[model samples]
Target chain A: MSERLEEICSIELPTGESVGVHRRRFTGGLGPHVAIVAGIRGDTPEGTRVAHAVARHLSTHHERLCGTVDVYPCVNPLAAHHGARHWPGFDLDLNRRFPGRADGHAPDRVARTLLDATRAADMVIELRGAHPAFREETQAHVRHDQPVALERALRANVRVVWRRSAELQGTGTLAAELPGLICLEGGVGNRLTDGVGLELCDGVLNLLVVAGVLPEDALPFHWAAIQRPLVATDEDIVRVRATRGGLFLPSGRMWGEVEVGTPLGEVVDPIAGETLEMITAPVAGRVLAMREQPVVYPGSLVARLVAT
Target chain B: MSVVFRLEAPYRGEYALHRLTFGGNGPAAVAMVAGLHGNEVNGIQALNLVAGMLRVMRPKRPVHLLPCVNSIGADEARKRWPFDDRDINAAFPGDPEGAPVERIAAAVMDATDAELCIDVHSGATTVREHPHARVPLSGPELEHARAMMLPVVWRRRGDRYEGGLVGAWRGAGREALQVRGGRGLALDMDDATTLARGLVRLLAHLGLISHQDTGTPSHDTDHVQDYRSMAGGFFVPEVQTGERVVSGKLLGLVRNPLGGEPIEEIRAHKAGMVLAVRVYPMVHAQELVVRIAEDAT
Candidate 1:
């Protein structure tokens, strides 16, 4: 077994310079192939971190692997370069350009190249970060209809496994192109959180093992350390919104259990100390995501709760 | 102008949704909205023009005109909210306690509670569109659009009414339609004037304004064909908006940006009136170059 690095595509910049999308491949005893993709949007640095973490572990244990593992870290290098959510010049979300045009712009071309390269893989895992506006709990999202993906996602070692509806999936997304795809994400966007990187890193490695890309004995940590996640459907989730426009001060911790009518947050005047409204849970549940950015208007989502 | 909704802008002063009222004896009989997309200036100007007419010729029925909903976005010449980059139109049936844009949307929804509602807008910044009314294939809204007598009356399917203020209004059981013209970030005087006249004609048709002459719609199309560039380059339109064309007519050409070579020549497929033409020259592959409203048989 050995490791090899390859350039999937190079995006030509306006100034004649170019940025390369690189793939780190680990090939061992032939079995099933798995690809871990990250950084379709520049803001999701957490995904990039987990990708590198998985790569670091596989680098040392590639010799004892059962199959091949391809880690594509920071596919949108140009966007990642400026920490933008979309390609700077075109203002296009790379994730929304999947199954892209062969003769399109650099972003579309890169999307096409990455899609074409990973289409043949047995398992596809997309690593992402929480929306920039919130701090989310560690979770794995699998299309509700994909039982095989849902069954495999259970071993991702996350706090929750969400079975999302197929309609909720945006068109041209990599997951939409590849059925049975598993998406793992959590933590604050752009900025990495404590323990989140390591948790997600372990999650990816466990997924690779589940896909037979790597041997279980090669795991850096014991398998028993992974926490079994609560499986939830769309109906099990509750969204709590702010009723007043002001600053949102969250009272609850991420992934903490709460009863109905429990205080979730408070919206207060930015200038004065007067509280505008107290947002409370409408149902007994656990906080899956909490708004991090404070400024709010009426109907702004303050927190998302997963029903108990 | 009355402040229907107000919210504090983070560092900036504050955001206000203003509505100009006329012939206010009772509930609003007609509601007209513009500036939902901040960069679409033609709608804003057209609504203002209607407001000017209402100032002199007092309407028989109550009318509500929201001339500039996204004032901040208009100030910055942005299509979406400047602060969060959210499309105000997309936040329809808005939450009163939601985000600033959503709150604004909710406020606009509440403010425009009328018997007949119209959401006015302009085409994308990259394209120029002739003054037109887009409504459901067969409904009261389509009749209202016919009364408006815009240059092009596009009868589309209900499925196309998925989001935005018009959809939101329709979802809430209101008869709603959309009026589009000109180009975003730029105001075409003729298109704006046409939109303004159409609104006046609609008021007349509703018996709110006296003795208004309704002009006929130049083109009524249910079959609009969109033409796209096969290659990425500088798009040069051979025809202008509102120009009548035959099948295989030269609609546009995509030329190599570097060497000035013709990469691909785009031609019309059906004999119709050119409803839209690309204004911005630089285009990507598969980008819309021209749209023609096909002649009715």
Candidate 2:
């Protein structure tokens, strides 16, 4: 076991200031190299925290590992510096600048450098947090056609393993770049939640063990302690939105099962304090996400559900 | 006034685009367009103000005024197309049979076919901007920009004109200029009036309109510099827009919102006019704090 951190790249801003991107490598013997990346968007601090946690555990037990494990805790350090969602001066979403140019601006150079560093890995895993306005249940997302990713995501100790079509996913995202990549996300954005970081850390470690990069006995917890997730498809997931603009008060809890037409929340006028409407679940399912922020627009998504 | 184009909306009624033409017409002259992004109401206000002036006066050459292009977005106070959230300015020289915003861009481009064009805009939501003209350094466009007699005529580099409406106009063989003022989603009456007067001055310089008091054109420096923040925090700015500054001057200070510890100090790099300043100061690291236009020696 060695304690070594490699500085992969450094991006120099227009003002002659720079930020370093560091990657930790755990190598035992030779097999397929697996890369774990997180915190592409600075608002998702949970991903960075989980990546560091997994790296810390892997460093202690690196001697028993088989394949190499590379962990990039935070890719966009400048954005992370201020807890912002986009690159600072550019006001650009870094994830959207994939396959970037080396000779371009600072953000482009950083994207190009990160892409180059991870291109050679046999498997890639991206960790993210829920949007800033909502809290999500721990889940793993895999492309429906990627059988390998679907099989690997089952061991991530998440509550729901969603296999969705690639077209449904947004363009220029990390998952869009790597077709079969597993994306694990939970918790709230910009702020850390209780127990979410540890849960995601354990999931990544379990994934590393399942990939034969880390030995089973090296895991901090027993294999039986892992949660068996309910595997689902795109059709089994439903998004519930509010029709009125107001404060959305969610009555449901994350990952809690409910019957059809169950009362999920109420939208009330923030000033008048009058209940405008009551939002209800359309089908019997488990609440996958609910709005944490009170204020909402008319088309704002209030909850996500995993149907039975 | 002519109805150049019309588009149908899903729930709302149809939108009609108006183009006002002046003069029996000599050689086709400048085409003035504004309100490409609907939330930039100052541009629309300035164009309309120019339109009112054009009604009383006659020009020696032809001038086309496209006052408001994205009326739907303007109605909702949105910067982009309300339907698809697409920026009309980005889809320039657009397809006639494309999406709603693209079709609007194509129609606007077709309507404003002239020798020279000027696209007017306001600043983004948070910042207030002085009436200024932006053009590439050392060109005919820069000369036209200087003739406007606006407060700040910024001769910027070609690289800064990437993928915008003005860029697309230049790409299509028309000498294009970009004029900016006020702020988005709201109208600054004085800035809009100043910009309107500047447009009249540019038209008179092109022999399109004859009006006195175009004023003695100030030959300002073409060199411009940007000032950026050093750290991430709530920035408290000490300077206002269009204020003159010397070297080592304090532009703003980044302080911790909770405990009020000074995180960083933003200072002017050179002696110049503060053309732009950060108004809403919840800033991230390396964000732009001030942009200065250095006076030519």
Candidate 3:
């Protein structure tokens, strides 16, 4: 186990000032290698923290592990320096430059390097945090056609496992490149929340156990404690948007259950303090995400509800 | 109106790049393109206004007007292609076999091959820009830019030209320049009129159009300076774009949004014409708030 664990790849930055990409490898006998990546975007600190939590548990139970687990805690270091969403100076989004050119600038070169490194892994798992404007519930996203990924996400301790169409995903992203990849995201953006990180950390560990990378007994928490996630499709998730542009004051909490016509939030005129519109739940479901940022545009998403 | 280029768009009809040509067309020269970004409607209006004037007058050489290149994005009021959010400007000298936006870029590049190319644009949605010409210091292009009779002729370092449409045109061995005015998403009739007049003056300078005294060429100093915010806060500008400022003048103030207390006072370091001003209040640390082009002595 110790011999196999020494094969992690770590690439230094071009500035010769930093380590850009760090990979931690854990291997037992070796059957199928799986990779877990987080913090492609600097604003997604929750994923980085969760990656570290999983790494800590894996280090203690290295002997019982099978195959290999490659963990990349932070991919975009320069952007992470100031907790920016995009790479500074270039102002490029690293995720949107995948399959990037080697001869290109700093961001493009980093994207190319990361893509080349992860291409050979048997299974790829990308971890991310919610958008900075909203607080999201724990969820696992898999491509609709990837039944194998769907099965794996079911065992990942999340409340709802969503199978989304590839068309709904953005181009040049990691998931777009790897169709079968399972993407796990939760918690708030830029900041880490208690219990959310630990739960997602456990979910990744449980998936590792299910993939035969780690033994069932090696897990710190009992398998019964993991939530049996409900499977949902893209159509089952409903987005609630504010009809008017104003200060949105949310009443519904994250992951709170609600029925149709329930008051979710209100858009009040900032200057006059008059209620412009009342945002209500459109379907009987649980709140997937709620806008944390008060200021919003006319079509700005205020909340998302997942139908049971 | 002639169809200069045609591009196929997904989930929508084909996009046509129309050209309004004027005069008897002796030596073909000077092509102007605007609205590559759909939200930049000021340039589109300016080009259309120029086209309307050119239709009545006859000139020696040909002038091609590409009023709106990103027609589909203009329909949705988006800066980039809505099908896949892509900036057509970034896809310069583009690929024919690429995506929808890239194909459009390629078509425009192929269609607008002329002696001189002017890529017209409005400022970003968050900022308002004065009518100005951006050119390199000490060159024939700089002299040509000066003849435009715009409010500001900013002679910048050539190294600043990279990855943009003008840069790509220069790389392809064509003389290219950029003219900017007004703000994005909104049309300023006065700014658009100024830009249209500047284009006419540029055409007259090129011997393509005949005009009686297109204002004495502002033999302005080629010097320009940028004003950047020192801290992240809500920026409140005291001066508007195109306003002449003296040294030691208050350009704007950066105030903390939470407490409404002034964090930093941005003062003009040099006496110049305010070429640009940040319209959006919320600013990040070190972002460009104003750009001042020093007036000729």
Maximum-TM-score candidate: 1
Q: Give a tens-digit lDDT track for model 3, residues A93-115.
A: 88898877665555666777778
True contacts kept of each: 0.23, 0.00, 0.00
Cα lDDT tens digits for candidate 1, B28-81: 899999998899999999999999999988888789999999999999999888
Ranking by DockQ: 1, 2, 3
The residue-by-residue lDDT of candidate 1 on A106-139, one tens digit each, is 7788899999999999999999998888999999
CA lDDT of each prediction against the hidden true structure = 0.88, 0.82, 0.81
Cα deviation in Å at residue A4, candidate 1?
6.7
For each candidate, C-alpha RMSD in Å? 3.7, 9.2, 13.2
Q: How does each model score on TM-score? A: 0.86, 0.62, 0.58
Q: List TM-scores of chain B, every candidate.
A: 0.98, 0.94, 0.93
* Weakest ten-residue segment in model 3 chain B by summed lDDT: B6-15
- Please list the residue runs of candidate 2 whose C-alpha ends up more than 4 Å from where it truly belongs after superposition: B1-297
> Which is superior by lDDT, 1 or 2?
1
Candidate 3 residues B13-114, lDDT tens each? 346788877767555587889999999999999999889878876667787888898887899998876544578898888866554566677878877777
Best by lDDT: 1
Positional deviation of A196 in candidate 3, in angstroms? 0.6
Clashing pairs in 1: A297-B98, A298-B97, A298-B98, A299-B97, A299-B98, A300-B98
Predicted chain B of candidate 1, TM-score versus the true chain B: 0.98
- Tell me how far the alpha carbon of residue B63 in candidate 2 is from the true structure, in angstroms, after superposition: 16
